[model samples]
Target chain A: MTTTEAPAPVRTAPGGPPAAVRAVRRWGFLLRRLGFYAAAAAAAIVLNFLLPRLMPGDPSSAIVEELQRVSGQQVPPETLESIRAIFGDPDQNLGEQFLAYLGQLARFDLGVSVVNFPVPVSELVLQALPWTLLLVGTTTVLAFVLGTGLGVIAGWKAGSRLDSILTPLTAFLSSVPYFWVALLALWVFGFVLGWFPLSGGYDANLAEGFNLPFLASVMHYGALPAATIVFSAFGGWLLGMRNMTVTTVREDYVLLAQAKGLSRGRVILRYAARNAMLPSFTGFAMALGGVIGGALLTETVFSYPGIGYLLFESLNKRDYPMMQGVFLIVTLATLLANLLADSLYVVLDPRIREQG
Target chain B: MVTQIMSDTDHDDAGTTAARGADGDVLRVTGLTVEYVTDGDPVRACADVTFTLRRGEILGVAGESGSGKSTLITALTRLQRPPAVTTAGSIVFQPRDGGAAVDLVTASPRALRALRWTSLSIVLQSAMDALNPVMRLGAQFADALRTHDRSLGNDAAWARAAELLATVGISGDRARSYPHELSGGMRQRASIALALACGPELVVMDEPTTAVDVVMQRQILAQVLRLRRTLGFAVVFVTHDLSLLLELADRIAIMYAGRIVELGTASELYDDPRHPYTRGLRDSFPPLRAPLRRLTGIPGTPPDLRRPPSGCPFHPRCAARFEGCDTHLPELVTKGGHAVACRLHDPTQRPQPAPGTSTGGAR
Candidate 1:
């Protein structure tokens, strides 16, 4: 029988560069990605201007009708004319209005919140954003860490007692509506149990200062809402991470790690869990985008002055400017979160680094 | 079973001496049977398979994809999963410490884990999935060494890993490279070096060179051969290519339907195959002596082991069929050192009427 002989080794092309140069190149790649995001943001602004024109009614006329209904009396012809003069010319073409809207956006003048009487939409949104971030951001991070850790354990020991117990429970929780769970938590933790405050940002009698009691009162009022968010959202994280971990545990690299005789814990944690966590990281990043939205019903039910509650109030009173501002911020946040997730894919998985 | 030949000591006795011969018999397996429960039915993957390997010997076990060759090697390492039951077997691994033969099939989980990479290790089939995409080659090697020997610090582990990579013909710098950065051949070599990090006595390779191109396959084979010579580790090389096996293996075992139909020295098996199935296999392989020669593929696929034929697994494919071949099963009988299970080779066995002829006079 004839045998094939070993082939001559092909000489590798010479490489030139130190670690510092490679680091700079990687940063350059990141900047190019940021450039794409800036382009998307510009397109979003243009769409915002064009979208209002597509609507059937004239926004200025709608405002006049709303003012008359709220006052419960028809305004005199002179006052109506004055109102029209300040708002805009009623007979102006839609093209002019659209161009004027674009001009306003260029100056960051989103206009006033009609429901709030005199507050600018941007100012109102900014006041509410920090509360939403505190409530949602903290809960999201906590859920992600707890859920991902449990998921890794469940997947590594799949079909064991731990998986048998956690899988069905998390699946049940995932199917339960978030609003229903929030309501239940409010009833149990807030009203019936009386362990936490029922509503508002802080205890009514607490002094507004950077003191321990004031901070404690703020945390107490925030507890039930935060718990509602965490409990309702944790199931999704757990189920998602568990599923991903199960898939990653079966990967050949994990088997190779086992073959290498690495400690069981190291194999599970480093090889299996780390790879399995990739999909969960994307989910977490997407959740981070929704932090600005918070939990609308929960926030409203608890009277928390977060962005979700403010957005709810704005929608009720037809506060178009405030609603638009909140929508733009939420949309931008979502897009940014997605972009971050994509960039992280390159960091977590080397296969994407070169291709990306 | 202690053999007289294995009892005598030599300078090569750096490990187990169960199957040690002057020619280097390092591992011996006998009566190995592996069955798996599939859909609540026990499917026999390997049945009564047996073979031996000398130090520095590559014993190629040739078969089609499902012929249980891969299953056999996996069973040798106890890597087979649940439902794939290793029902009955004795994989006597000759240890490197010159200790008594250890039965791999019956070893405890702890014992098996300890023996892995230190005494017997496996090089898996797929190179793409073998190395962790997240970890660098050096880290992976260090992980292997650190697993077995905890005293190895990070610096020491990395140094040892670099040395192992260098031994496998890879540069020390390549150790820092992640698996994705390396080529397919490089990945396979890195995997091989990882397997050999502890300098195991026997390395069980399952389709180790199949993933690479033909040229790369040769390079990997040559590297394995060179390492075997320098380290004196035995190998149980499993592959589907008989021609490659003929070149690489000192002895070869031909498996058919989960059983070893023929086992002999590579040259002897190639020159004169006693079993009809072995003959068919030898004839089917593309003849290298004549480049223009048409390769003949075997006529039928291997029989399903779940519902194997009663008399002989190879009866349907065998060219020489006789009466009683359908009624009696052949037992593996020894002729000198070689073993074959064919009724035609028996002295008392009588030839029956040829096919399509009357059986009145022959009976």
Candidate 2:
């Protein structure tokens, strides 16, 4: 490189403040994206406000009626109005109610739940959040890691025995619905073999603090349900990643890496797999976001105490506030996950970087 | 000197060896044949191709697509993978340090590993695709350096990479940017810089300038020549464009249907090509400074190597084909450092196409 004579050279000068310009453009891109997400969030909240009214029954009315029947006394009309207000009155003018709902949202008050009267919807979501995060979140990540790793190998060695066996196996497993997977695992492991407990997030015998026994019980009982969701979703990640890896293997960079005399391992790791893993990384982030909503069927089958189980219970009781609260959380979390992935992808792929 | 004789197959005892660097021949390729084994018959991508790349010389390979220009380079570097089998020939590389000539066709994996990047390297065609997208330019350069020389520190490797980039007239922190951040010309130049990172004695380039614009291409070629003069490394440049080669190359090899039809010094082949295919190829490039001659595209497609025409492979498209051209094959005959495989230049052949006649009245 030092040998060039520089004869007849036409040197283009580096422009001033190009770096600063690039940074400004990147920041602009981020601001624009934030604005777009804000609109999405607003739309989602408005939908959340309207969706609870469409539920078949009302939680406040059911609770009030049950109370009156049990006590053998009619509830006062003023008290009835206050109970209705707590769960949102569907009879109110739609436009005015939406504005009022937005006003209440601004104050960080999600209103008290009628089903669990006097308990705020926010506290309910908070209580269930960690369990869902632990069970579903961990499983989703495990599935992605296991699937993507296998996928890289399969795609790298497309016609090998590993690919031939795993491709169809994973494809078949992917077709099994969540309920079926949970039910089948429950029947075999819990009922037939009795090697695992049938249902519940923790052992009925243990106390509910942070002791080792209770923690062990949570995982022990959570295992079957988690496996159901993870195994069912695992195959899709594997197939998607395998297909991506196969395509990426043919990319010119992989060939270039080989031409540079890098070892096969370096070529596969640095060139083939790194590029192939981009789509999988984005998929994993999106999955993580959505998993916050909880795996409904798996949770329901296992009677697990996650957000999905709470959603099911609230829906069964026609608990409008609880349903609305859970739905809003799910929507917001999913949106946030997608946005984070998009930003990270921009970081990973320079082709889309700093091009505001 | 155990004189190397390249027979029909690449695996035939690798022929022989000699004091290869004595006459400045950095690479001696003889009877190299690479075949693609399809379901039916094996297609010959490169067939019995023989040539020598001298020290510090730019040997340009000019041919249309499917003319085996790329395959020839792939064979020379042992980069040909399965389905594209090297059926014949030997590529004898004379080590720059005056060590015994190593036959690349027979070099063990460990030996090849050690020799690569140090003595031999390659620049792929597409600059954008050549660099790893996920990796920063500095890291990619570091990767190339660390692969062969593991003892080199990161800072040293990065400094060397930055130095290389500077020689290509890129004097900035652009090495820290990804391939996409750099312009096409810059990326190509970076690739060139990487090829020179280990100070290889010979660099094989597969259309290095084809991906960049014409202006950039000229600049890169000029830089390559100047670099070659200073670094004293031989280059085997392959491209479909002949005009660039005519201007930049010291010597040229014209391939037709997997075979080198003519090999000569750049000016000799440009002015007085004896092979009809070579003449057609030369005419195809619209001469820039000379009198304006209408550019005539070659009349026919390249012959299918799976079932190639017998005798002379270029006979179907040759404008000056004699009767013997369709019946007898002509071996490359050397005269005054120029070689042409055609009856017109074959002193032993009789009744050649009548002198000055327009090829059997075909016009």
Candidate 3:
């Protein structure tokens, strides 16, 4: 028998040259994804316009009646007519009003808050935005990194004493309801021990100057709320990351890495941990959108000047403008967060980019 | 009974030299028994299995899915978990520097870790799941090399990895590509390259080509043979295909119901199988040259190892069974370098023909 020196390379259907062809394919795919996002955003905006109309009561009449109840005085007919004209007469044609609302959205003018007297919805929302960002954003990022690191250690040494200790603790913490945990924390840290202030945004005694003392008081006031946010949310991240790491450890690639004689630490971190992070990464992005809207009940309980507290107040006062403003911001933020995640998918996994 | 026939044959070659060619045996496994404690019952997966693999030779272990072929290889590497127990047996590996052979079965975890990759390695089945999609291939390779050898610099580690990739028929440039960027064949080749990065003396491959296309399978097999020639490492090749083994392996062992029924040179097992199970496997593969011929499957499924037959495990599926076949288990007997486990060839035991057939019809 004759043994050939080299075998011929396998060939398949022509798909053009590799480099230039793959680049063009990638851009084409990204364009398609962008188109899908644009379509979805348009649909959401349309739904936003239609939603308020479907509400049971007339928003204009509700605003007027609420104002009268607060003032405890009879308003002149001329003044009431002027308020109606400015807010949009309830009797106007639905199609014309819808067109007018769309025009206002295009110009970035969400109009005024009907519930909060004389306060523009945009100004109120912006004021609350920074607080939520500082509280939840910092905690979420910290939780992701710390939880993932711990999870890698736990999963790699699975069935050992460390894993045995951590697994059940994380499970218990994850099962505890966030609100229940917050209430318990408030009772202990606030009412019982008096280590932290029970409620409110900043210390009432601090002067309105950008001084070190004022900043310190602000941080002091933030301590309880920030702790509550981290305590309630940290468990979810830890449990998610730990479970994912366990599953990733069983994957064939991880076994292959171990068989390659990679050091135990390197195998756990570079191979197992990175792959395990994929599922948790997507979850974290979704959580980012929710965080922007802030924790509604938590903020209400604390009397914090975050978007959630603002939304609660606006709902109680029948503040239509403030409510519409907050909802629009939330919708946009969620869509943008999802868009960021999809783009991240391309960066983290080149296969998605190549498949384009 | 078969032992008598073997001793009779051994007497004819008493003066042959055995020592000069004996040093090349890299791994020798004898009487290996493995069982699993399943739902409070011990299920035997391997029993009294014996085989030897020499350096620079490929030994193919052929069997169906439930034949305990994978368990045998996994046991050799000490990769089996708790429920699966290695009850008895010794897996001895002859060191490359002529040191004392180490028994793998009883080695400590630390000793096993040190011996792995440099002395022994394994290649798994699926290429897709056998690579970290998030990491660049170069970093993955360097991670493996860095584990055992700390003296090598970053550049040198990468250089060595690229060289190893070339050895597996992949280009050095492909080292920078992630696993997902590579084709299925390329990914398998990369995995094989990683297995050989530390220059292991023995590599256990379990169905490495099972997931690839037919053409890619042949390419991979050819590449493996070529690497074996250059590296001179011993291999324990496990697969379900007997025909492919004919071209790649020097020796072949057939397993049935968690036991080695026959062991011989590739040619001997293919041309003159003595065990009924081996004969069935041989008859099942269609001749390569006759493409249109119908492939014949074995008549019955393998016995469930949890509650195996009393005597020979293959007796239920064997066409050559006689009256007393169910009463006794046969010991493996060596004859002219081939080992077979059967009772018909002994002079001490009465040679009763099978119930419905004559001796001539059996052959």
Candidate 4:
């Protein structure tokens, strides 16, 4: 029985903008995000150039001392000059050399490592990257999925024993550092039990190939370090998400969802969990971008052939070019992660998009 | 009760308002009480409230903030959760299609779920936050329908949602828009549409237009009244705005403290109010059509439910309070046909004049 009454006043017109204007606004929003990232990336590159200079020791002198240690003779001045050129000119002022380095960076050249002699810094970084990505990346993803899933259940059923027990237990685990946990795992499962290998990325007999046997051994040797990373990181995600979900459950929209006669499961998933998980998603994205950096001490304790372990080796030998290479990768990775999170937040919350 | 309500009909403004719909009671709430068990002490939010909703009748619940109108509505719907506990009461809700009456106070979750959005639905206080911001308005409507009736497929559910949106005068194309995309007025209308999607026999709205502009508020109420006429559903509309209720409600109930002190037909309550609290409520709203008059607010704070006063809850503010009013608890008793819970109307009792005779029509 619909009546032909006067039409309802369109107080706020339904559509806000024309299709073409809206499209332009969307593109402008994307450009703003990218612009922010571009500025941050430049700052990070400048910081990378200045950080090594902050160190007390000279970059070239370390190379000379190492040469003396290997050959049991003091290196000649001519030899030192040649070696300095390979790293970068030690004679030039810091400003000129920085300009030279920036020019070389633009050309995608990281120069030869002072310690590795003829090996390009790029080659050393590339060789160490896959190990870090495979180990740290897999563990981070596993922890996020597992932790967020458990957190959703725990927060929804907050007063239950599972919530009471899991919240504290995760808190305690998260307080301990990754390396300390790795060492503890080694003590219990490696040293005391002798159930797994103590060090290295793979079995000595296995060649580094994509063959099934070699890959299986790589995972086998990588297990302890991966577990250590996951064990420590998952707790933060779990706790953060648990608190978020608990707060989100009280939101009016979630209550509205329940009033709609939706099952508790759907209300928690669609309303509570989705909103709660936004902050956690940023953490996950950052972790993903830093995947190439690897868990530093976890890799060191296991002597795995990851970037973290390689950084440790380079640090000891005073490998200047290699250090710059790895630091630059880390800087770029962090900047990219921040950019990803910015875009991600806009997508997750339309309210933010409107404000922007 | 009939005798008590009828006594005040001499001054009743218009005759044919809510009195015509006093037939079969669709809901009977007897001795319904709800309390908040907070840390410091238990606060009685709504106490011993009793009312009946006739089929297709509109009931307006009026009170100031902290007066428990919202609590009573939430409790009636079995939506009160801890720490707001339903301490004592029985709410008998009968399905319009003639199923056995269900006690909402003791109904199982499954039973409540089945009743919500199908037999009875609610339009919450704030429409802005009541909607799922991430989902499209149509998607939310479809979700409500589909969740209740799983046999309906996605396409059918969507079509039903579009139709419901149209019923509220919102275009079908706006279905894809999110809540934030719509203005405040449209969002409120969308919430109304969501409540009506299932064709509920009763709809409970808690201050639905409080956040809108004054002009939009009147427009929304007009739209709602028109819809109710065609759809034939009962309403329990709660607001702190008594003027809005006078224009919109069929029956108006004035609450003081946690208890409803006066309940009558709109004209009887407006023109022949007997309870001091109801008079205070009526005087607070300036009559738009009447000549401009000085308006003074109710003088004192409402009794704290945690430690309520010994006698009549409104004695501290009651202009016509008597000696016995400070010591004797007044029961809601019928004087003629109107119901007033004030000591002035306590029959067999005080020789004090009721507000109708004592205060005249206007104090």
- Every model's Cα RMSD, please? 6.9, 6.0, 7.3, 7.3
lDDT at residue A71 of model 3 (Cα atoms): 60
lDDT of 3 at B352: 51
Local accuracy of candidate 1 as per-residue lDDT tens digits, B105-210: 7776776787788887779998889888888889988888888898999999999988998887788877777786677888898889988999888888888988
Instruction: State the displacement of the C-alpha of residue A15, model 2, in Å, after optimal TM-score superposition.
Output: 5.2
Q: What TM-score does chain B alone reach in each candidate, compared with the true chain B?
A: 0.88, 0.92, 0.90, 0.90
Error of 3 at A64 (Å): 7.8
Tell me which of candidates 2 and 3 scores higher on TM-score: 2
Clashing pairs in 2: B9-B88, B9-B89, B10-B87, B10-B88, B10-B89
Model 3 TM-score is: 0.84
lDDT score at residue A39, model 2, on the 0-100 scale:
96
Q: Per-residue error at B38 for model 1, in Å?
A: 2.5
**Chain A TM-scores in order:** 0.82, 0.84, 0.84, 0.84
> What would the per-residue lDDT of candidate 1 be over residues A247-319, giving only the tens digit for each residue?
8877778877777667788988889888888778877888888888866887888989899999999888777
lDDT, candidate 2, residue A35? 87
Computed on C-alphas against the true complex, the DockQ of each candidate is 0.34, 0.35, 0.31, 0.37
Badly placed stretches (over 4 Å) of model 3 are A1-17, A42-110, A113-117, A145-173, A207-220, A354-356, B1-22, B151-163, B289-297, B345-362
Residue A34 miss distance in model 3 (angstroms): 3.2
Off by over 4 Å in 2: A1-17, A51-86, A89-120, B1-23, B291-297, B352-356, B359-363
Between the candidate structures 2 and 4, which one is better when assessed by TM-score? 2
Candidate 2 residue-wise lDDT, B1-363, digit = tens: 323333334323221122243457788887888999989989999888888788898999998899999888888888876678899777888776767777888877777777788889999999888899879898988888998898999999898888999999886477777776677898899999989988999999999998888999999999999999899999999998988999989889998888888888899887887777877888777788889887676788998888899899898887777677788988876776788888876667846437556443211
**In what order do the candidates fall by DockQ, top score first?**
4, 2, 1, 3
* Two-chain DockQ for model 4: 0.37
How would you class the docking of model 1?
acceptable
